[model samples]
Target: MAMPVSDPGRTRVVVTGLGAVSPLGPDLVSTWEAVQSTRPCVEPIPEAWEAFWKPKSRFWAPLPKEWIQCPLLAPLEPKQLDPVSILALESARQACSGGAPAGRGGVFVGTGSGGGASRFENHLNHLFPQKEFLPGRRGGRFNPFCIAMGMPNSPAAMISIKLSIEGPCRTFSSSCASGTVAIGQAAQAIRSGEVEWAVAGGAEYLVDPDGTQFHGFDVASTLTRIPTREECNRPFDAGRSGFLFAAGGAAMLRLESERSARERGAAILATLDGVAENCDAYSPMAPAPTGERIQQCALEALADAGLLATDVDCINAHGTGTEANDRIEAAMLERVFGRGPKVTTTKALTGHLIGAGGALEAVFCVQGLLDQIVPGMPNLVDPIADLDFVLRTQASEHRNVLKLSFGFGGHNVALVFTKAGTP
Candidate 1:
C-alpha cells in the first residue's frame, strides 16, 4: 500500500501557543495547576443579579477584576471597548507572545453575548428612567464607539487591531459552539493556503452592569442553580440541573502549519487534526431528543480525522451539568464510542464561558494530550450513564481526543486533537 504525500498547506496544523484568562486562573499554567483540585473554583456572584421582576443568578465564575480594571488597560478609554473585546485582546496577546511579526495571519474569535453591553441598553435607560429597572443614566446619550464596542465581531476586530494582524479577520457567533467553530474555520483557512498563521479562539462576557445577560439566561432556565453556596455545577451527576454560566473569559491558540512552525523554530503544543460541524435543525432550544444528529456529528469528526471511534482515547465532553443535555450527550457517546473513551468535563471550574467555553475546553484538551491527564468532574456524585468518567485528576495516555460543543439553533461541532508528533 502507498499513501500520497500532502502539500505544506494540507500537511499538518500545530498549536504553537496557548493563552487563556479564566476564573480558574489567569494564564495556562495557573489554569492547569488549579485543575488538580478535586473541587471547582466557582464563586457566589455579588447581589445575585437583582432584577425587580425576575430571578437572579447566584453562582458564577469570573476572572479577577484586577486583570481588566480601567487603570490596568490605560489608553483604552471606557465605553470604547467591551469587556469581551478586552478579554480577547489579552488572550490573543498571550498566545501571540512568540512575537510573530504582525503583517500576516488572521484573527478569528467567538462571543455569544458580545452585544449585550451595547448602547441599546442605554436606549432602554433613556426610555425607562426608573431605578432598579435599568442600570444606566436617566437620559444620557451613549459614547460614539457604542456600536463598535458591542458588535458581535468586536472581539475579533480588537484582536486584529491590537496585534496588527492582516488577512481574513472574522467572528463566529453560533451560540456556544462559536469558539470551537472559529478554531476549525482558522484551520480550514490554513489548509486552503489562505494564511501561514492565525489566531483562533473565543471570549465571552455576560456579566453586564444592568444584569440583563443574567436575566436572559435565567429566564431561559439554563443557568444552573444549587441549594447551597458550597456546591455548584455538578456535570453528569444524576441530579444535574444546568450549566453554571460564567461572568466570562477568553482562550486563544496560535496555530500555524507544522512546516512553518519548524521553520520559525517554535514549540509545537498539539495538533488540530480534524473538525466537523452539523446542524440538528430540529429545535432551537432542545437538542434532537434521539441524539441522532450529535451521534452523526461525532462519527463525521472521527472520519475527518482519518480515525475510527476506536482510535479516540478521551472525550472532553461538553457536559454542561444539565439534565437533558447530559442524558442525550451520554447516550450519543455510548452509541459512538461505546463508553470506551474516558469522559471529562471542566465546566464546573470554568463556569461555562458561553462561547469561550469551547476554546477553554479545547485548551484543556491540548494540555490533557501533553500531560496525559484528564480532569475530574467537579461535584459529580451519582453517574447518569455507564460511561468512563474521570472522577479525579489522573494520568492516562491519550493520543487522540474529541471535543464536542453544541449551540443554540442546533450548531454542533466536534474537533479532533492528536498528540503533537503522531503520524
Candidate 2:
C-alpha cells in the first residue's frame, strides 16, 4: 500500500546541516579531505581477533577509536550505549548543535548493527558466566539497562531525547539501505506538514569484541580476500573481488522545510528534490539478474522530483565492489542513462559501511556540490562497464545528483538532490 505523500505545492524540503563519524576521520571536514584524496582506510585485521577464528579476509575498515572519545557528543555515557546508538547520538548531536531545539521536529535514524554490542554482551554474559568468549572482555555480568540499549530503536529514541524532538520518531531497519530510507522518510514528513524539521541518517558498529560479524561475512565469501589493504579496496573494477567491511560509523543530515529554513536564516546546503523506495521480491540477499526493479526505482525517483533522465548530472552509485553487485548496478545505470551521468563509487574510500554507507554518501553528495567536484576512483584498474567513472577529482558545475542504495534483502531506495540556488 502507498503511504500518503504531501502536495509538492504545499512544502519543499532542503538540507541545512550535515554530520558524520567515519573511518577516514571524526568529523565531516576531515573525512571529506580524506575522501577527496581517494584514501583507503582498510587495515590488517588485528591479531587479537584470531582467538575466536581465522578469517578469509585479512583487512578491515574499523572506525577510529579516537572519534568515539570526542567530547560532548553522545547524550549519555558512551559505555551505557551500544556502539550503534553512540554513533547515532554523536552524529545527531553535531547536526542539531548550533540551532535551537526544534519543538516540533521529528527524529528518523537507521541502524543495521543494533545487535552488535549490548545485544551480544548481555546475552552471552547471561548464558555463560566467567567465560571470556569475547576478546578483551569477560562475560561474567550483565547490566540492568542492557535491554534498552540493545533495542534497534535506541538510536532514534536517544536522538529525540537529546534534541527534544517532540514529533513522530522512527528507526528504519532496511539493512544497508537503512540510512537512505530514513533520510527519505524524513523529507516526506516535512513535505507532508507532519514536522518542521527532522534529524535523519544512520550509524553502524558491527564489530563485536568477539568477532561475530567478521566470521559471518568472511565465511560467506563476501569480504575482500586481497592481500594488501591498498589492493583490496576496488569498486567497479573488472578484478573487483568484494567489499571492504568497515568496523562502524554514522552520518546524519538535518532537513527542514524551505520556508522554515528561510525564516530562520539557515544556510541551505542542498535541495532534497525527491525520494522513492521499493523492494525486489526476487531475492532476500541478491538483486535479480534481470535488474528491472532497481532501474524502476531510479526512474520513479526522478518522476517524483518532476525531472527527466537528462536532468541528472552525476550519480552516487551503491557500488559495494562485489562482482555481482557492480555488474548488476552498472547494467541498470547504463540502461537508464547510457553513459551520460558521471557515476562515482565511494565505497572504494569509505568501504562498505553497511547501514551508515547511504547516509555518508548523501553527505558526500552535498559536499561534492559545494566543492564543485566529483570524487575519483584510482583503485579501479579496469573498467567493469561503459558508465563514465570519475577516475580523478574533476571540477564541474553539476547540480542534480542521484544517490542510490540497495540492501541485502532487496531493499532499493533512490534520492534526488539538487545544488542549492537551483530553481
Candidate 3:
C-alpha cells in the first residue's frame, strides 16, 4: 500500500468546519463565547464524592446529559447510548452540519479511557451483595454492546457509520495528544490526496464514580478540592497544582483547500497551514523536560507553513496546570519565540479534557483567528516566570495562532493556523 503523494505545490489543507462538546458549551459558538468571557466550567462532583476514592478532589468539568443527543445514535434508545458514543456523534454531527464535503469525507477521532465509566458501573452492579448469579452475571455481560462501544476506536467507527464516510476511518490514542495527532493525520491524508475531506477530533467521557476512583489511585490528577469552579484550574500560575480532569468532545473538518470548499459552497472557517507531530521517546508519562522534541515540532510546523516564529501572534499552550508541563512548555515557547507569544490555556476554562483537549483547543485557535480574539487563562492570578499569559481578559489582536499539544506517551503535536485572508 503506497500512499500517493501530490505535487508539493498542488495540495493545501484548510479547515472548512468546526464542532465541539465541552464543559463550556455543546457547540463551537457557545464554547467560544464562554471562553471569551473566561467562564469556569469546573464544578463539584455531581453525586456523593465519598463513593469515589474519599473525595481527594471534589471538582471536575462534567458535560451535561442533554449535550450528547445527536443524530448518529438516533437508532438507539436514549438510555442505551454510551457517553463516548454520544460525544463522538455530537461532535461529528456538528462538523457535518457546518459544511463537511459530500462524497470524499472521512473520519478520525482520538480518545483516552474510552467508556471506562460504563465498564466500571457494570462491574459494580454485578458485585452487589444481593445480585442474582445469572449465566453472564459473573463476567458482567449484561450489556453486550458495552464492550463494542468501549473500545478506543469506537468513536471513529461510530462517526464514520453515522456520516456514511466510506473512505479512511481511524482512531489515535496517544494519551492527551490523541486529538491533535488525529487532526494532523487527517491533514496529511488530504495533502497526500488520499481523501478530499475528513472529520477529525477527539472525545472523552470518564466521569463515573468508579472511574474517578481509578484516576485518584493513579495520582496523576490535581486533587484540588476547591469549592468553586473559579479556583480549580490555574494554568501557568505559581499556585497551579496539577491538571484538572475534564470530559467532552471536539471535531473539525479538513478540506483540500478553500477553492474546493468554495466549489461546494462550504463555509470556510480557517486555514490549516501546517501540522507537525513527533515523539520524545524520553519517558512514558513525563515529557522530555528540556522540551527539545516539542520545540522541534513547533519549528517543523512553522517551516511547513513557510512562516517564522515572529509571524505567530498567539499560542494556545498545552498548559495542563501541572508544574512540569507548564514549566516545560513555557521554556519551550521562550526558546522558540525569543519572547513567548501572547499565550493562553483554555484548560483553565474547560479543565483538561485528556484526549479531547488538543482538538478542542485547536477549535479555539480557529475561533481566535476568525473572531479576532484570544481567550485568557481564567484564574491565573499569580504569574510564573516572565511569560506573558493573557489572564482574565481576551486579546483582540491575533492573526496567526499556534496550537501545541503534548501527551503522556511522549507524543508532541503542533498546528499552525492563519487567519482566513492570510497568505
Candidate 4:
C-alpha cells in the first residue's frame, strides 16, 4: 500500500505511553531504576540451558521470573504461543494501560530472529532420537500453532487481534534494526493520516536451549565468554570484547497524532519528531568501515525533524560492546554531533536485545527527555573515543534526543525526539 504523504506541521506524532519487559525488570519503572543504578543484568547461563547447548558465551541476560507476573499475560497459553508473542502482548498492554485515546490504529513489531526455536529443536529430536537434546513428542505431533507462533509477523498479528486494530498491521525484519524500523514506520503511518495511533516496537526471543540456534553466532567468533556480570559486556570501553546475549524482551509504545492526543486529553510523553533509515550496502554482517552512511542517517533524521545537531542534547547509542562496532559508532557520533550531546549505550546494562535494542533504547531516550536526566553507561571504564559519554546519571534540561540503531546486513536507522510541545 502506498503511504500517505507526510507533510510536516500537518500531522505531528507524539508518544503518549511506553511499556517494556526487559532483563533488568518487567515494566518501565523497574527497568529505568536498574538503568539509573548501573545494575548489571547479565547472568551466568541458566542450568536448564546448560543441560542442552554449551554456548561459547557462558553468560546471558534472562528476565527475572517475578517480572512476568503481568495480569494481562495470565490468559496466554504458553504451550500454544511463542514467548516472543507473549512478551509483545504484555508490553503493549502496559503501554496502552494508561487509557490513552486511540483510533483504528495498527500494530507494528520488529524482530531479528523470529521463532521456530523450540519447534525446530523438537523436529531435530524426532530425526536424531536424542535423549539429551530436545525431546520430541511420542506421536511426532507438534502443536497446531507452531507455524503461526514462529512467523516473524506473529507478534504484530497477535497484537492486532487482541487490540482489535483493523488498520494496516505490519512486521519489519531488518536484523537487529527491526524494532527501530517498525517504530519509525509506525510514526510515519500516523503522520501520513493513515491511522490515529499505532502500537509499535520491537521484541526478540532468539536465545534458546537449542545449540542449533546458538551455534551460528558461536562459530562466527562473536560470542564472548565473560561469565560474571561485572566482567562481561562493556559498551564503548577500550576493554570491551563483545556483547553478551540477552533475554527475549519487548517494548511497546503508544504513538498518536498530536491532534488526536489533545482531543482525548492524553498525557503526552514525548514527540517523535523525525525518523530516517538507510543501508551501507557494504557487507552483510559488518558496518561500513568509513561510517559515512551511518552519519548521513543521523543528519537526515535531524533535518526531517527541522532541527540541527546542536539541538540534540542526548543520544542513545547502539553500542554492542564489540571492538569494531564501538569504534565505528563512536566515530559516527563524533562526526555527526561532535563532542556535544551526552552519549550512552544501554547494551552495557541490558546486553544486546538484537531486534529490541533500538526500541528499548528509544524507551530510555523518551524517559530521559521527560525526566530531564541522562542515564549513565554501567561498565564504561575508559572511553573508546573522545565523545561525551554519560559516565553517571546526571540531571539535564534536555529537550531533544536521538536514538540510533544499526543491524547486520548494513541497515542503519535514526529517530529524533523532542520534549512534548517543544518550540
Q: Of the candidates shown, which would achieve the greatest TM-score relative to the real structure?
A: 2
- Quantify all predictions' global Cα lDDT against the true fold: 0.80, 0.85, 0.76, 0.81
Give stretches of model 4 more than 4 Å off.
Answer: 1-8, 47-54, 67-70, 73-76, 100-102, 125-141
Please, what are the lDDT tens digits per residue for candidate 4 over residues 68-185? Answer: 4445444556666678887887788888886746576878899987774656744654565534334442234456677776788888887887767789999999988999999999
Model 1: residue 229 alpha-carbon error in angstroms: 2.5
lDDT, residue 368, candidate 4: 84
lDDT of 1 at 225: 67
TM-scores, all models, native as reference: 0.92, 0.95, 0.90, 0.92
Q: Cα deviation in Å at residue 165, candidate 4?
A: 1.2
| RMSD in order of candidates | 3.1, 3.0, 4.5, 3.8
**Candidate 1 lDDT over residue span 1-423, tens digit each:** 122223434557889888888887767778888886654767776563553444544777767765573223557554688778888888888888866933259998887877666645666655664544535334445556777876888889878876788798999988888899999988988877788889999988876655677677778888776756556688888877778878788899998988888887888989998788999998887788899888878777777777888888999988887777889998888777777889988886677888999999999899888888888875778988888988888899889989999998889999999999887
Superposed model 1: Cα runs more than 4 Å off: 1-9, 54-57, 69-74, 101-103, 128-141
TM-score of 3: 0.90
For candidate 1, list the clashing residue pairs, or say none: none
> Clashes in each model (backbone N, CA, C under 3 Å)?
0, 0, 0, 0
Q: Is candidate 1 or candidate 3 better by lDDT?
A: 1
Q: Give per-residue CA lDDT, model 3, range 1-423, as digits (tens).
A: 122222458567778777888888877778878888887787666555454355556677777556867765656544554677678777777777744575576788887766666767666555663464553333334565666755777778778877788999998998889888889888888877788888898887766644553365236554454455677678888887777777556555454555578688776778887788999999888889899999889888887777788777888999988888888988888777755478888898888888899999998888778888888886888877566778865657777788999998799999988888665
Q: Write one digit per residue (lDDT tens) for candidate 2, span 1-423.
A: 122332458588899989899998888888898877877698888787787787888988888777875355544577677778778877887777678534379999988877467787678778877776554667866767888878899889878887778799999988899999999999999988889899999988887767788788888788888888678988888887788999889999999999888988888899998799999988777878888888889888888877788778999999998878889999888888878899998888888899899999999999899888898776877988888899776787799999999998999999999999987
